[model samples]
Target: MSTQTQTETIVLQPTPHTEANTNENESTQDQSPPEVKWMYPKILSAGLSFFVAGVNDGSLGSILPYVIRSYDISTDMVAVLYGTTFFGWLVAALTNSTMTQYLDLGPILCLGAAIQILAHVLRVWLPPFGLFAVTFFLASLGQAYNDTHANTFVASLHGAHRYLGFIHAMYMAGCLVGPFVATGVASANVDSKWYLFYVFPLGVGIANLALVGASFRDRMASALTSSRRRERRERNASGGALKEIKETLSISGVWLLSWMVEYLVNVRDGDVKQMGYVPAGFYGGAFLGRLLLAEPTHRFGERRMIFIYAVLCLGLQLIFWLVPNIITEAVAVSLLGLFMGPFFATGISVGTKIFPPELQSSAIAFVFVFGQIGGSVFPALTGIIATRVGVQVLQPMLVGLIGASGLSWLILPKDAELHRD
Candidate 1:
């Protein structure tokens, strides 16, 4: 039995009252809390972790320019530092399923927060760029675990669609705040300003740590009982982690989705953030896009919305490429952010609803891991193109990649399949 949406009633099996059944059996079953009632807060609380993750990642990217200038590093080295975050995600994607088997959701979330806090402290104390990059990777690795686990946990909870949207939107909210807060701090002090970026996350991380402790007991009790049954079966299977991974990779739709995100990032590739006007424009648009359109877009139907967004995304990339003046580029990026803002959230909402609960976390991770792959590969490709062809060609290449992702939308399952029980 399943309750896919929050508005829906709890779905549970009724126990039979046979000749052998006794009064004690009825009392125990009667005492159990309704599934829907218990699941609501669990999903909501888990969503906050995604919020913290967005704040952590968004703030770092926003402050990257300060780090580069402060350390007197080459541009390529700076890119490598960003690249390490992707490397961390890649490593997490590879190992997460195995790790989840032994650990409870609450412990995992708390540990992730702790890791991120330590990484922040390390960045503040350590002088060298190498350590900075290493710490950033470590932080991302922690985030990766929390992100996947949170996605998994919420997918099992009540009202998957609304919960998924809120969770992802919270991440967007964090993204919206991170740059503004970091930039504010940085602008206040010209010298030694990079250290200022750590302030917001350090505070949020502390709050999140406390929340984890409050919810840990109830959430873990539910998670262990549900996940353990699956774990036992997996253990009984003769094939090990490598086999599980290979099996996961073999799914056609999963690979196709990964390709979709990889291409999307290719279209979005470059240092759009570090430049004064461009990052501001992109995220500013993203902030407005999410606020104004996320709910309506979801209401219209996630699949069709993605298709429309993809087309608009392609156009935005084209505008950035061919249009003259930094102002025009900024406008184009804003539009890009506006259209692309809901893409990941929409993908996750639709993907979770379509896949069975057992497969939900891995599937969400699969899609996000592709986004990470895109984050890593596309920027490097753009670097090569900019060096060889000219920076002017970057937008046109983005247009092309956007078109590729849009084309893949043709093969995605229809809206009916998306909402099916």
Candidate 2:
């Protein structure tokens, strides 16, 4: 969908002339004195934030064994870190919409970067095990803030789907780089300096903060004030943070897309029973698919192509399930990743088109949080079930999930008019 079509679908309540003039005056006064051309900078800043987040996410597994050895902890104890990470995302899910009510884009992004930097700093020094666990919480919290806002902003731009693809591809690229760097750093002096791997993320986090601050500085205060003023002027009863969250949670697309991603992640690793390198093939395919298929997916239609991708992914999963050969499984998994890559960005694009501008950030955040929930919960569920039904069940489970995802997508409202909040 085009930006114009999206804008047209929103029904903004008219403000009284007197109040409008007052708001205009206040908005003008609130804006920064110096104007900045922020388009490219914003894009770069958003991409860098994703890169930092990806590095944080991907490097953890590489460094985990070292952490286990250093702390003299069992493998099961590592679940604490994952729990903390989930808690961080949970916090974001509950607070992000409310935070945006008071904090401007620049301040929020800066705050997230600061939190991430603090996380890395603690890790690089090899803090106590408990402190190290806390670091994951901080990093995840920071990621939640940065990623949700960046996605919302990018989804509003012209050719948004393509840019979304580019930013996500950057994330996958960072993921690819992280394991190598962390493994290399940890292996250098396996006993002592494994913690130094965090230095890289710390440096990148600083750069992320700088870029975001520079890009969004001029509009920071004004954007917040303007949005609030518009909400008040329009007398939008549903504009409150709570209401936005509720509405976002109610959307079908949010749940379906979340399920799709959860199934994708679980199926690729759990079902295929592949070695580490094979999963890398999946990520590599996804990276290329996002870069190569982005434009065509956008041109063809996000809603239409998503179902097609889901079907393709489902077929590949079936092949992987029935086929016994590791080579064929690897090939099928990579192709599945290629098919699934575009779904996420396309889903975000769909949200942008269907949601009101004022509620975009919260809606997108809710969708992402839903995705995170599924990604964490379903895999854990699969693990427990695997203990009983065996890991072989993973393939059929994924097939069912993918089928449901496609059906849900088919029922979702498309290009529907939304009331401005």
Candidate 3:
């Protein structure tokens, strides 16, 4: 934030008009760099936050096989794990607005990183099955906090679409790196010690905490210290929390991402080393998609472009399922990731334009919460259903999701109507 704005806000009385002006100023003030050049550090810290989130999410699919075997558990256990993750997000969703009303970015973000580090600490020791499932709750709670705040901040910037894409692509980059590291660590032994893979993200999460501390050092103690400001805060918390959940769905790569590697390995009978590369490929495609597609998505307009991309994704998913050749399926899945990648960032960009300024931050938080709900719920459902039938169910289920994704975009405003809002 600019010095003048900070100074002004620090001195302002808790009056209604003054509060409104402060909130409005915050929308553009953070983007307008202060003479000391603080924005880059904060932006870099935000990117690192996404990378941490990506590693946590991306590694899950790769390590899943080992988890199932090592625990001697059924896919039902995975469902329970997802259920725990669901509650983590649920808790964050319920409390995030209240937390934001009282705390500033520094405290909330630091708290999130600390919680996630705790989750990883629990996992690295190879804890009991029940405890292991509970770790996801902690992880998701941390992720919801980080994801909502970082996304809202970036989306408020000058070139928001580009920055949004960059941070999200950082997530895909983490997703890309996660599987390679996870597979290597998990497969190194005759008996797979998959829990050891978490040390990497744990270390990274520590750095994220430190980076956030350094970046937001200016605002660390500048929270809402006055009890009189309560009424003003209630308005801020009301709706701004809703927009965040839409953007977080990219984390676990939806239903197909969780199962893609297993599908290649189990269904196609490909070697682990070879087939394990598929999720990485999907993330790589997604990485390029966010980097390459954001501008076109902006220029051609989000609603139409995303709809076209969704249609293309559905076709690619069909190709992935129907083609008998493993190479063909592999290529199809990656392309699907590429097309699907733009959806998360683009959705955030749209929400910022449409939402009132006061509610934007909390709105973004709520969006993350809803996506967390979806990300956990559907995959958990898939895990339960897979136990009944098989992982081959991914093909039809994924195709339906892609189609529904296309239809969902229709509900967003048309390109011409966007700026008018």
lDDT (C-alpha, whole model) for all candidates: 0.55, 0.63, 0.74
Which pairs of residues have clashing backbones in candidate 1? 5-159, 6-159
**What TM-score against the true fold does each predicted structure earn?**
0.75, 0.74, 0.87
Model 1 worst lDDT run, 10 consecutive residues: 6-15
Give the Å shift of residue 67 in candidate 3.
0.7
Q: Kindly provide the TM-score of model 1 when superposed on the true structure, using C-alpha atoms.
A: 0.75
- On TM-score, the candidate that comes out on top is 3
Ranked by TM-score, top first:
3, 1, 2
Clashing residue pairs, candidate 2? none
Tens digits of lDDT, candidate 1, 72-104 = 754345556557776876667555555555555
* Predicted structure with the largest lDDT when compared to the true one: 3
Candidate 1 segments exceeding 4 Å error: 1-41, 221-278, 380-394
Q: Of the candidates numbered 1 and 3, which has the greater TM-score value?
A: 3
Query: Backbone clashes per model, in order?
Result: 2, 0, 16
Off by over 4 Å in 3: 1-37, 225-228, 236-255, 415-421
**lDDT order of candidates, best first?**
3, 2, 1
